[model samples]
Target: MQKKIVKMFDEIAPSYDIVNRIVSFGSDKLWRKIAIKKSLKHLPKNPKILDVACGSGDMIEEWKKYTDNIIGLDPSQKMLEVARKRFPEIKFYQGLAQNLPFDDKSFDVISISFGIRNVVEIQKAIEEFARVLKKEGILLILEFTKPEKKSTIRNCIDFYSNKILPKIGGIISGNKEAYEYLPNSIQKFYTLNELCEKLNKKFEVIEAKNFKLSPASMIIAKKI
Candidate 1:
């Protein structure tokens, strides 16, 4: 799964950001803004943030408004190349989330946005997120969630994500499977209660909010 993800992301590196913006109707930036603001709430006095699966460093760039001690990590070198080009001053590393290359308690805040679903070992990845964070450090995860309402809105989202998103994403990224995997993975991903259960094993949940009509969510937890 890791190899597949690396190849897929590498293949779409050149146009991933463009497709993301288009497919999200330019709401991707807004979502990142919300994640950053949420992170700031529990950020340390001299916060050092680690952004796991920091694709194209979008979250890292948004985080700069709040802190300068930022490190972006991703498994795809192609994605890191794009991130480096965009934010030359910020640090970018090619690494996996399940096995982070950092000392214990190295960061005051950790964040992953729309990337946790791709992790081959999701629990291991969460453990790693907990390991690198300082005691009481915050972990902010922004991910796609299954909507609670099962109505016209759900049907519309399903149609858009399953049928329309892949087609448009394929045309833009030239990798239809990547886009196809997007919705499929989200559908298979854990529910909010399930995720909180997993996270609570390592950290205490401070807040959990569902957005975009519960199709998107942000979970803020602190290491105990």
Candidate 2:
């Protein structure tokens, strides 16, 4: 299953960014920006950053705004290829979140955007995040979560994600299976409180907020 997910991402890596912008209606950028800003409040100047599951290095780009000491890691070789080409000065690693190739207390901040849900062993990945981060290091997660409550806007988002996003994402990326998996993964993912509870085991939750009219949310935590 992990191999298949990596293969799917490799096939769609070239078009992933374009499809994301279209499918998210450009809100994905805002989500990352907001999360990064929140994380920065707890970080020191020029803090080292590790962007796990970075995906063409979009989140890395955001981190670059605050610091140049940044590394990107992803399981998909093709995705890392794109990221390396885009930011040749920065290092990119092809690795899984469950087992990061880094020393303990190696980074001041670690972030995973829209990629944690794809991990086959979520707890193991979270443990790895804690392991690599220094004491009081920031961990930023911007992801899609199942809605905690039913509402009119939630209904609209559900309809768009189920009925519209995959079709458009598939058309643009030319990999419909990958796009179809997006909504399904979100439905199976933890809610905001649930994910924070898991993070609380190794870190103190600083802030968590769901975007208005969107299922996307962010959690910022500090290593305990």
TM-score of 2: 0.98
Each candidate's root-mean-square deviation in Å? Answer: 1.3, 0.8
**Model 1 global lDDT (CA atoms, 0 to 1):** 0.87
Residue lDDT tens for model 1, 1-224: 79998889988999998998888888878888987787687775658889999989888878888777889999998999999999898888889999999999899999899888889898999899889998999999999877655678778878899999999999988889999998898888887778888987899999888776336788999998
Q: Tell me the deviation in Å of residue 72 in model 1.
A: 0.6
TM-score of 1: 0.96
Model 2 clashes, total count? 0
lDDT of each: 0.87, 0.91
Model 1 Cα shift for residue 100 (angstroms): 0.5
